[model samples]
Target: MMQLQAEDFGSWDNPALDRATWMDIGDNCGELDVAIHRAAARGDVAELSRLLDTPHDINARCSSENSALHWAIVADKTEAVRFLLSRGADPSLRGRGGSDGREGDDAALCAARFERVSVMEVLIASGVGIYSETLGFAVISKNMDMIRLLVGTMRYDFTDMPRLQALEGILPAAVRTWSLESVQYLMEELKYDASTISTNNQGVLNLALLAIFNQEDVHDQLVETESDKDWGVAIQIIQLLVAAGASVNAVDDWVARTPLHFALQLQYPPSELIDYLLVHNADVNVPNHMGRTPFFQLLTRSDATEEMVRRFQRLGGSLDVMDDEKNTPLHLVKRPEIASLLLVSGADPASKNKYGQTPLHQASCVGDIGVIAQLLDYGADIEAKDSSGQTPLLAAMSYARCSGFWEKDTRTINFLLERGANVAAFNRDGQSATQLIDLKGYHINNLGKLALKVGHHVRQTQDNREEENVVDLW
Candidate 1:
């Protein structure tokens, strides 16, 4: 029965106004305030009754565009909201606050965000049901307590929402606000079961990756916690996951990569962690989603020296293995020192990736004349054609515009041409090298022909984009 004060009446846009004036007087008949007159915000009954007695509408909207009923419902003022409803206020009316008009959904979300359990209860009793937005609000609130209540007590389905399902690897934005007590409550007291983690769904590893990148301290803490377990806890977790019948060789279904692929890509993993996985017989040769084998990845680094190379070799890693593209380790080596070790260790220069292009094709494309010479010395094939029927020299020409090659590249070009690379060889399009160069507006030369090929690929990509013009910015 609180009285609406004089200050409550003012402009609807203003948050503070005289509540009594807004309730008792119509704006056209007399000056009426809106902001303070909101039933939920004012919580004043005498002013509300006075306004009801006047020609002024009981459900008049405030500056925020919310009717008095909308305000009371959102604020969880049940009695005030009920009184307004009994006087013919619409309980289902939407407000300017949230886009959704179902006052129940928006208010429940706000309540979850504020951690107002009582408010949430009152809203539920008033007929609000769980929805995607509310579930998301709970996660974004980082109120694990609220999530537990919603899931356990309210029987909300945790896996039903697509947004929640897509949140793999990314920590809830609100995780930063979680207290240590909250963390303990989730991991220990509630005994929340993390799914049997595989690389597919955002599993424990995905969480670990985000933690490592976003909040290093949390990552360090998790690492420390695992260190105390038998089997080097994390390693054991992975092992147990595999042993409990998770796929040890589960190549990433999307990229066909294995978990080992990600571990190696991290650039700085715990040495002990790496050693632990290796000791447990993790496949060092497993390829990832991109079809890149572990051995191929190791050879990609300029920093990998004799010792690292030797360790991998000693570990029985294959050097000639190719990814889905058939790219051999020997094909990508730029360091002469590493190349020497590779040959001495029996690396195959004639090996090809799925594309059927050999190490010589790769070396020439990079304009690495030194590597080219070394491969030739070891009897590498220069006339190899990929599935596209393009030769080493043709492939090299396609990339000539990317980097400046030494004038001596003519000798390599002439060598391949003379060795049957087909100076006039047409690609899959049946266009001769000369014709391709002419069509692309470049002079008829090896490099010029390569430019034409690049232009062709660009045009193809552009066409694809134009066909799918409705791009999602999000």
Candidate 2:
């Protein structure tokens, strides 16, 4: 074996050697140095072995402070990694010499980054210290086995705040990936408390529910079998967490929303999970930060189902409960089924929100004839005025121009007219329904024209009745 001079190894300041680094290296290195870097990176065991025996510096630092072992591990070259470890390579060496003074990649960290469990084992066996960030990397890769090896077998301190933070950070990803086994290992075997681990200040249940909700949105559009698999995993994880004693009513600190609230807000809400949580004694009427209960949240979704409303009612959820805005569940009703369910459950249709708007007022705004009719059937005040002094008739006309559904809006206006909605009523702005229509420049179609004519006739008939009463009294 021929021994090379120190000068032949090249100075660290030499741009050729400096530019041939791994991640931090620029593409300005000489071809020879680049070839050497490539050989180590690609894990060409024979070539690396031949080069190593030539008195070349095995621990030569690249521009980014990465050594041959770091490159080998990053490339996932298990054989080259083993060979280098056996050849007295320092597994603990970190990359250095960057402008920002940032530490370079170590062998263990590199192995964890690429999720090479075998290489990680070899590095750990070589007495390399595992950083908290290494565990986070494994979690990021969703490698349950790697996580077990690091925390369970390697005995990395799980009590450390960084490790705990890493665990918390990965909970959402675990839920998103539907990694029930990994979640179970973290919660059960590792004793990670699901209640304590939150993503964005939301507990594990909240995170799981949000994940399910998002997956449901995608599941609705997908026609394949795999679409349901993710949702199924989410459901299982929710069940697993509950069975493991996770708090079903754990409220998100930011929104004060429980898992049930999230479940209700989904486009295709999961009834099974809702029922499961309720069975576990999750509060059916727990008020969120805005004072809205799960029932209130349910009414906000356009696809609120009759079965969901019935489930809540069966669970003893109160329909008349009001939020901070004083809006009852009935005030937010967008679907006829929801309205009907509330009515059957003894909800007050005439209930006024903080805005003094009744359920009928809200129904009129949306031009939902079914909900409007149901509210009326339940004795909702069609002429009821809100705090703004706007009646349901005026409310319907005011909102009609902005609703974009001209036909639906016209039908709602005409329905209110035929049902004796007082179109002559004025709001607090001193604006009557007809005045508002003209002020807003609403283009009323033929149906709106008929409604106006019928409204005028009704008002005239009322005036005539008053005159007749006065003559009789005289």
Candidate 3:
């Protein structure tokens, strides 16, 4: 072994770095380390030979605890990884020393994941089983060159690997940067589970939802490939997972919402997907972690279509279903059209939420005089108060955040005042509607309060049979 200093080889430059006469057999391990380094830098295969012949340990662990082969493979130096592999540098050696429980920790998979296509090809041709965790990184990165080299050229089984599970939820996140065609390329070409039939990870669902939200071309693909599809393609994805032994009721961890419930809660229309879930027997009443039922989720809609409303009705949904706060679907009706639907569906206009405030109180807050009149015609209480004893008119005024956005119905306010909705009626805070407005004084006049009381009685009498329809709201 040569005891030469680093300066001896300081100016040493290789021309072919081959099986020539310049075999430096100094410190065997030291020379081997330097040989691997030079081989990596110049892609010289013969320099590696001279070092192997010079008596260095091919499997020597470097200072980082990785063997020479580990660093070489990780750097994706094909000649070095191959040379070490050929020289009995164990391919199963952990790049970082293996933990007591872990099995088969190789650096070739890491190289493949990072887009070292050549190195992956070399390792695969040498008979390394593709590691799924490393393969997940490759799939998520969408390194098609590396993916093809691993699967197509090497004949690696995509479904056989357990690490592919990690990629299930990651592919969707790539859409923020990659094209829809890229996502489709993975889905259609690589079979990366566009339907995600195997994993419970929400990454696939999130990507699908986002694709729809962004109106990506994958949405068109989902629609285009709908023939012979179950639960629509969207719902069928879940259904297929279920049929393939995936959980049908798998609630997502982030929102704690099942796929069916999420379909109802989304702002954009779900179209056939919603129908597919219902037809496939998805639990319509499944509540989210927040205790909000799918019915309440649907009720949160502002611009909900008539079709959505009718579908909820047809799905055996009860109008009386309450949210955590005890607010029924009727309490959330913002438009007169929805109010009419709720009323005709037998929603009690006078029913209170958990707050003991009726749908009338919420309608008042909306300040839609038309909806207020419709509620009144449907027998809403004129003098109903919440747990705080505040009247509907006062409830409406409390939520007026902007200067003019609320613009309360003066006609309805006056009508309620006339019907004996006491102008002096104070809530638990002892604030009256007139005082909430910082008025000059108690403007509680008698004439307005009288008209409100008369209209209330007349409307109540007209809807005497509302009790009859309540049982049929389901």
Candidate 4:
């Protein structure tokens, strides 16, 4: 073998960065760190290694204050995360990386929220902080396997009383997620306090009830079938909380309304849960801080069916009940089905709110032709006026602008006109029905500037290519 001179080996043999190159990287490290972020985000571990192997700190953050480890976590690049961790990326250092509409700031916590199990496993193994908040985020994800990984891991033991105590705050999240598995794990297995009030001073059980509306609002997730929905998940969640000492009759600090109040008031409230709450002594008539009872609050819901109204009345939820504004259930009802139920069940259609707005006026203002017809049939004065001196016809025109500007609003106006509703009537605002309608048309026209907000766009002609003339919605 030939003996190699140190001079020959100086720049080419060892193959590490020279002193000046190291200094140069340190000087322009911010720009290079973005390259590292881009590489990690793309999961190009080969490029990641090449960047980190440069003469600089492995934990160097990019321009956005996120480290390469954060970009890897953001992109769900599990292998890249592992490679970064192995290459000395600080797992303990919180990465301020977050995606659009993603909830948390900590990358590991966001991982738990999104149920990125493999990514979370790599993070946990690399000694990421077992934040108690992260535990709640894990529960919110409703992923049993992810929950198992966190609590079952050696470093993050639920059996550790301190950790268990720290996790007590996770009950609200468990309730909100409606995850029966999480409920059982936290309440049954770990004994997290189900009776614990939330930060808003609301009962944990009430949050479980309110989350029914919340879960329905998540449009991205595919709707699960009833059988596949973990067998009446809402009712089961309520049952678990109640069984764990949560009070079905408990009142919130803000509303002073019990869990029964939520079950009755919200749209599409679980019927089985309502039955469960009532059977367990949930008082539907208990007054909230707003001076409204559960029955009164129930009236405001647009989804209450005719059968539900009759059933509620039979179970002591009286249609005779009135809100703080003195509006009877008949006045508050928006659906024709519920209005007919109340009218037939002896609710006076002539009832008025504190503002002297009669039920006919209420129906007209909401542009509900069915409700207006129901009220008229039930002896409601067709020409009734509110305190504002607006007749039913005038009321329809004044509020028709808020009718979501749909064709049904004009149909309601025509319906009233056909039923002897005077178009000559004027309000205290000195605006006649025709004048108000003209103003509404002008408003709709100006909505062109806010087309996105109004959700209005001219449809195409029959050919479906070129833009057609704007249809006069008014």
Best by lDDT: 2
lDDT of 1 at 191: 30
Instruction: Candidate 2: give the clashing pairs.
Output: 95-104
Assess candidate 2 and give its lDDT: 0.66
Looking at model 1, report the run of 10 residues with the lowest lDDT sum.
Answer: 465-474
Off by over 4 Å in 1: 1-37, 42-105, 113-128, 141-252, 266-282, 302-316, 334-338, 354-356, 369-377, 381-395, 402-474
* Model 3 segments more than 4 A misplaced: 1-35, 52-76, 88-106, 127-131, 143-256, 365-371, 401-421, 439-474
Q: Taking the tens digit of each residue's C-alpha lDDT, what string does model 2 give over 250-333?
A: 776656667787676554656676677788887888997779888777766688778766777677777768988888878877
How many clashing residue pairs are found in candidate 2? Answer: 1
lDDT (Cα, tens digit) per residue for candidate 1, span 245-295: 344444544445455554555545456755655665657787665566766
Residue 462 in model 2: shift from native, Å? 26
Please list the C-alpha lDDT of all candidates, in the order they appear.
Answer: 0.52, 0.66, 0.55, 0.63
How many Å off is the CA of 249 in candidate 4?
Answer: 3.9
List, residue by residue over 1-474, the lDDT tens digit for candidate 4. 121122321232222213223112223432334567768767899998887678756677765455777667655789998998888787556543334543323556646644567888987787766566667656755677777777766356432245655445566667666677777776654553546644433344455544443333222221433333432776787776666566677775545666676556544556776778778877667776666777776666777666665666667876667777787877777788777777777889777889989988888877788889888877888778888888887877777666586576777766775566654577897776656655565222222323412332332123322334222322
C-alpha TM-score for every candidate: 0.52, 0.73, 0.61, 0.58
**Candidate 1 similarity to native, TM-score:** 0.52
